[model samples]
Target: MQALQSLADNYNYFITIFLMVSGLYIVIARGNMIKKLIGLAMFQSSVYLLYLSPGKIVGGTAPVLDPAFTVYSNPLPHVLMLTAIVVGVATLALGLALTVRIYEAYGTVNEDQIFARDNKK
Candidate 1:
């Protein structure tokens, strides 16, 4: 039971690392920019997960500064996660826009194919 609890406590962090690695793998192995964006999103989400995991308490409220509220939750992580998510979304949008530009310029989305054609030329 103790081991199980310990595992549960650290599970989110482990998952976060796993997701980060998976995202890195996708970004490195995939040729399509859209796929890379998807991978980037996964990485961002994992970071959010990491932030949220630390702020978790058994009983917590939304960290609103109200006089009536006595036991306030840790809002720092949540706020940071929200900001991170926004930044991540912006990055993804930018990446997708860049992919569109790449497609327009090269007429192909595959990196290998583009390189091959370039080499031939």
Candidate 2:
């Protein structure tokens, strides 16, 4: 149905929002470092979805240098998304590294435990 198609077309953004909220909830409520990483991945995946969905055109062609080709593909969004992916990966790596350090220092990754320990000092 046309209505279903329209829903599908907009579903990516909704899914992205869900992922982001789930990630935030995990980050706030979870006790494990690995779970937090998974949440972070989810958050980033949502962003990737956001970047990818808009760049797609139904009747667009790839931007090639062939003389026989027309319809220039909108490459800006793709390029921006590539950059975003790189930055996201870097941020994830950094976050993971920080988590590792937190684990080493606190012997537990739970936020409450960490806060309690800090308060004792």
Candidate 3:
């Protein structure tokens, strides 16, 4: 029961871990370039969750001159996450564009198929 309660208490970490493993598995298990990109995006999402999950407070307020609020939430992680999201999107887009070019050249997006075709030549 204590373990279960502890697990519930840190469910966010578990979720992040799950996404990370799932993403990694997808990336390794699949041969398609697009699927690998999707997995990379998932892994990036897990990292974002890892940073943002701890930085948020349920009822925390921003730092201000007023004396009423004692707890202030840090805004740095959220800002960083926004930037990371933009960069991740750009990376994904570039990866997809490259995949398109690879398909055009090799007539397939599967890495194994491309390698086989290369070996034939």
lDDT of 1 by residue, 1-121 (tens): 9998987978888899999999988999998878978998998889998889878765767877878767766889999889998999999999888889989988987888889889989
Q: Predictions ranked by TM-score, top down?
A: 3, 1, 2
Worst 10 residues of 1 by lDDT: 56-65
The TM-score, computed over Cα atoms with residue i paired to residue i, of candidate 3 is 0.92
- The segments of candidate 3 whose C-alpha lies over 4 angstroms from its true place after superposition are 62-68
Evaluate model 2: give its TM-score: 0.79
lDDT of 2 by residue, 29-68 (tens): 7777778777887887788778777777767677667777
Residue pairs with clashing backbones, model 3: none
TM-score of each: 0.84, 0.79, 0.92
Q: How much is 86 displaced in model 2, in angstroms?
A: 1.1
After superposition, the stretches of candidate 2 with alpha carbons farther than 4 Å from their true spots are 1-5
Q: Scored by CA lDDT, what does every candidate get?
A: 0.87, 0.82, 0.94
Best by TM-score: 3
Q: Residue 90 of model 3: what lDDT?
A: 99
